[model samples]
Target: MKLLRVGPAGHERPALLDADGVARDIGGLLGGAEGAGGARDIDGSLLADPDALARIAAADPAGLPALDAGLRIGPPLARIGKIVCIGLNYHDHAIETGAQPPAEPVVFMKAPDTVVGPYDTVLVPRGSTKTDWEVELAVVIGRELRYAASRQEAMAAVAGYAVAHDVSEREFQTERGGQWDKGKNCETFNPLGPWLVTADEVPDPQALSLKLWVNGRLRQDGTTGDQIFPVAEVVRYLSHFMTLYPGDVINTGTPAGVALGQPEPRPYLRAGDVVELTIDGLGRQRQELKPA
Candidate 1:
C-alpha cells in the first residue's frame, strides 16, 4: 500500500493508492466521516490494521476523481512533531567526508518548518554557500514508544517509509559556531513524499538502492545496504533516550556521493539546478533549486 496526502497545502486530504493502481479517498476513513471524534484520528495502529487495509485494497477507485498529477503532495503525516536525523550513518559517506566511522550514531534535528512536498523547489538561502543534497530513507514512526524492548521490536514500531532530500548548508553546519541544526533548518530544506510505502510492502529496508541527481547529473549514488546502523537498530538506539510518537519522523541518513564529500568541495546551489532522488520501492522525488 502506498499512502499519500494530496491537494494544496493546508487543504491536503488523506488518500491511499491500492495495489491495482487505483486511488481511494481515505480522508473520511481517517476520521470526520461522522464528524469530529471518529476513530481517534487514524494513527499508526489504525494504519497497521489488517481489516482496514483490506477495505482500502477492496475499495472501488472508479469515479473517485483521478487525482490531479499537478497537485501538491505534502508530507504523509499532517502534523510532524519532530524531524530527527542521523549523521555519518553510511560507511561510504563517512569515508567520502574523510571521517572515520563513529562508535555510535550521531543524531541531529531539523526544524519541522523545513518539511515540504517531494516536488517542491529547494530554496538557496540568500548569501549562502555550501548548500548540498542528501538522499535519504525517512522512517515514519507509527507508535509512541520509549525504551523499546529490543531491536526486533523496534522494527515493528515503524509505520512506513518515504524518500527525503536532507538538504543542507555546509558552512552553517560545520563552520558556524553551533550544532548542525543551524545549517539544516532552512525553509524548504526537507522535500519529502511521492508516497509513503507501508513497512509491510518493503521486505527489507536495508537492501534497497538509493540515489540523487542535481539537474541531470548524478550526485549521490549508493544504497541503504551501506548504512552502518540499519533501520531497526536506529529505532532501538534512539528509543533508549527519547520517545518516538506517531507522525514523528526519523531521517536514517544518506549514502555516499554528496557534494560536500567532493575533493574540490563545491559550495551552495544556484537557481535552476533540479534535484532528483529515489529509494527503491519507496518512490522518487524531483525538486528544483530556486533563489530565495
Candidate 2:
C-alpha cells in the first residue's frame, strides 16, 4: 500500500493511493469518518497499531471518497519524533568527499521541524552560495527497538521506506566550524515523501537505486548497493546507542555525485533550481528552490 497524506500543510487528511492511482480518504478508518471531530493523523501510534494497518489494507478504494487532484501531498508520516542521519555511509560518496570509509556509521541529526512536503519549495539560506543536494533512502521505524542483537531484529523494526532530500549548505556544514547539523537543520531542508511504501513491498532496501537532478540535469546517480554500512547493520548499530521508536526516521546517506564532489565552480544549487529525486519502490519528490 502506498500510504500518504493529502490536502494543505497542517490540514492534511490521511489517504492511500489505490490500484488505479486515486487518492482515497482513509481518515475515517483512522479516527472517525472523514470530517469527524476525532480524526487522527498518521503518526507513531498508528504505525504501531497492527489492527489499524490491517483495517486500512482491507479497505475498499471504491467506497472511499476520492481527494481532489489538486490537493497538496504532505510528508507521509506526521509527528516524526527524530531524524537520524548517516554520513559518508556510501563508499562512492565517501570517496567523492575525499574521506575514508569509517568502520562504523557516522551519525548526525535533523530536527523534526526541518521536514516539509516533498513538492514544497526549499529555501536557499540568505548569504549562502554552497547549497547542495543529496538523494537518500529514508527508513521509518514502526517499533521500539533497543540494543538490537541482529540484522533481522533491526529489519523487523522498520515500518516503511521513503525518498529523502538531504539538502545541505557546504560552507556551513564543514567550513563554519561546527557539526554538519549546522547546515543540515535549516528550515525546509528535508523534503520527504509522496508516499511511504510499506516494508513488505520494498523487500530489499540495499538494492534500491537513488537518483537526483538539479533543474533538468542529472546530478546524483547512485545505489544503496554502494553503502558502506547497509540498512540492517546501521539500524542494529544505532539501536545500541539510542532507542529507536515508532515514527523515528533514519536517512541512510546518499550516493556519489553531489555538487560538493564536482570540480571548481561546482554546480551548487541556487534560487529557482529545481531538485527531483526518487528511490525504487518508494515514491519521488520535486521541489523548486527559493530565497529564504
Candidate 3:
C-alpha cells in the first residue's frame, strides 16, 4: 500500500495513492465521520496498526473525492516522532568520506521539525556554504521495541519505507565543535515521501537503487545493497539502546558520491538549484534550494 498525506502543509489530510495512481482521502478510515473517533492528525497510532494498511489497500478510490487539482503534497505521515540517522552505514560512503567502515552503526539525530514535504523548498543555512545532499532509504517503525532479538525480529518492526533526502550543511557539521546534529537539524533538511510504500510491498530494501541529482546534474547514484550495516541490523542494534516507536524514522544511510566526499572545490547547493532523487519502489522527491 502507498499511504500519503495531501493538501497544504500544516492542514494536510490522510490519503492513499490508489493503484490507478489517484489520491483518495482516508479521513473516514481515521474516524472523520460524525460521532467517529477524534479527528486526530494522521499520527502514530495508524502506523502501529497491522490492519490499518490492509484497509487502506482495500479502500475504493472511486468512492472517495480526489484531491483538489493543485494541492501541495505533504509528508506522507503526520506526527513523526524522531528522525534518526545512521552515518557511514554504506561501505562506499564510509570510504568516500575518508573513513573506515565501523564494525557497528554510527547514529545521529535530526530534529523532527526539520522534516518537510518532498517537493518543498529547502533552505540553505544562513551565512554558510557547504550544504549537501544525500539520497537515503528511510525506514518507518510500526511496533514498539526495546531490544529486537535478531535481524528478522527487527525487520518485523518496520512499517514501511520512503525516499528521503538527508540534506546537510557540512561547515556547521565538521567545522563546529559539536555533534553532526548541528548540520542535520536545519529547517527543511530532510525532504521525505511521495508515499510510504508498505513493508510488505518492499520485499528487499537492500536491493533498491537510490540516486540524487543537483540542478539536473547527477551527483549520487548507488544502491542499498552496498550498505555496510543494512537496515535490519541497524534497527536491531539501536533497539538495544533506545525504544523504537511507531512514527519514528530511521534514515538507513546514504551510498557514496556526496558533495563532502568530492575533491576540493566541489560546489554545494545554491539558491534556485533543484535537487531530485528517487528510490526504486518508494517513489521520487524533489526540492528547490532557497536562501534561509
Candidate 4:
C-alpha cells in the first residue's frame, strides 16, 4: 500500500493508492465521513492495520475526485514529532567524505520545519557555499518505543518508509561553531514523500536501489544494500537513547555520489537546478532549487 497526503500543505487529506494503482479517498475511512471519528487523525494506526489496508485495497475509487489534480503533496508522515538522521551510514558515502567507517552510527537532528513535500522548492541558504544533496531512505515509526529489546522488535515498530532528500549547507554545517544542525536545519531542507510505502510491501529494505539527479545530471547513485546499520538496527540503536514515537521520522543516511564527495568540490545550489531522487519500491521526488 502506498499511503499519501495530498492538497495544500496544511490542509492535505489522507489518501491511498490501492494495488490496482487507483487512488481512493481514505480520508473518510481514516476517521469517518467528513473525516470524523478522529480516524483521519489516526493515519499512523491505519497504515499499520491490515484490515484498514484491505479496505483501501477493496475500495471503489470510481466516484472519488480524480486524485486532486492540482494538489501539492506533503511529507507522507503528518504531525511528525522528530526528524532524526544518521551520518556516514553508507560505506561508500563514508569513503566519499574521506571518513572511515564509524564504530557505531552517527546520529543528528533536522528541525521539523525543514520538512516539505517531495516536489517543493529547495532554498539555497543565504551566503551558503557547499549546499549539497543526500538521497536517503526515511523510516517512519508507527508505535512509541523505548529501549527496544532487539532488532526484530524494532522492525515491527516501523510504520513504513519514504524517499527523503537531506539537503545540507556545508559551510554552516562545518564552519559554524556548532554541530551539523546549523547546516542541516535550513528551511525546505528535507523534502519527503511522493508516498509512504508500508513495511509489509517492502520485504527487504536493505536491498532497495536509491539514486539522485541534480538538474538532470546524476549525483548520488547507490543502494540501501550498502547501509552500515540497516533499518531495524538503526531503530533499535536509537531507541536505546531517545524514545521513538509514532510519526517520528528517521532518515537512514544516503549512499555515495553526493556533490560534496566530488573531487573538485561543488559548493552550493543555484537557482533553477532540479533535484530528483528515488528509492526502489518507496517512490520518487523532484524539487527545484531556488535562492533564499
Which has the greatest lDDT?
Answer: 2
Candidate 1 lDDT, tens digit per residue, 1-292? 7888777876676677755655456754543233133333334545545566566656665635556655677776666768899999999999999999999999999887899989878899887878899999999888787898898889888888999999998888899888999889999999888788888889899998998888788888888888999999999999997999877889999988888888774734678888899888887899888888
Question: Across residues 1-292, which tens digit of lDDT does each residue of candidate 2 receive?
Answer: 8999998988888999998889999977885322222467787788888988999999999999999989999999898999999999999988998999998899999999999999999999998999999999999999999999999999999999999999999999999996888899999999999998899898889899998888888888888999999999999999999999999999999999999999998999999999999888787899999999
Question: How does candidate 3 score on lDDT?
Answer: 0.87
Model 4, span 1-292: residue lDDT tens: 7888787877777777655665556765544332233336434555556566677766676655457556787877776789999999999999988999999999999988899999988999888878889999999998888999999999989988999999998889888887999999999999998898888899999999998888888888798999999999999999998998877899999899887888774635777788899989888899988889
TM-score for each of the candidates = 0.91, 0.97, 0.96, 0.92
Clash pairs detected, candidate 2 = none
Better of 3 and 4 by lDDT: 3
Q: What is the C-alpha RMSD of each candidate to the true structure, in Å?
A: 2.7, 2.0, 2.1, 2.5
Give the least accurate 10-residue stretch of model 4, judged by summed lDDT: 30-39
Task: Give the better candidate number (1 or 2) by TM-score.
Answer: 2
Q: Assess candidate 2 and give its lDDT.
A: 0.91
Candidate 4 is scored at a TM of 0.92
Judging by TM-score, tell me the better candidate of 1 and 3: 3
Give a tens-digit lDDT track for model 3, residues 217-266.
Answer: 88989999999988999899999989999889999999998999999897
Segments of candidate 3 deviating more than 4 angstroms: 32-38
Q: Model 2 residue 142 lDDT?
A: 96
lDDT of each: 0.81, 0.91, 0.87, 0.83
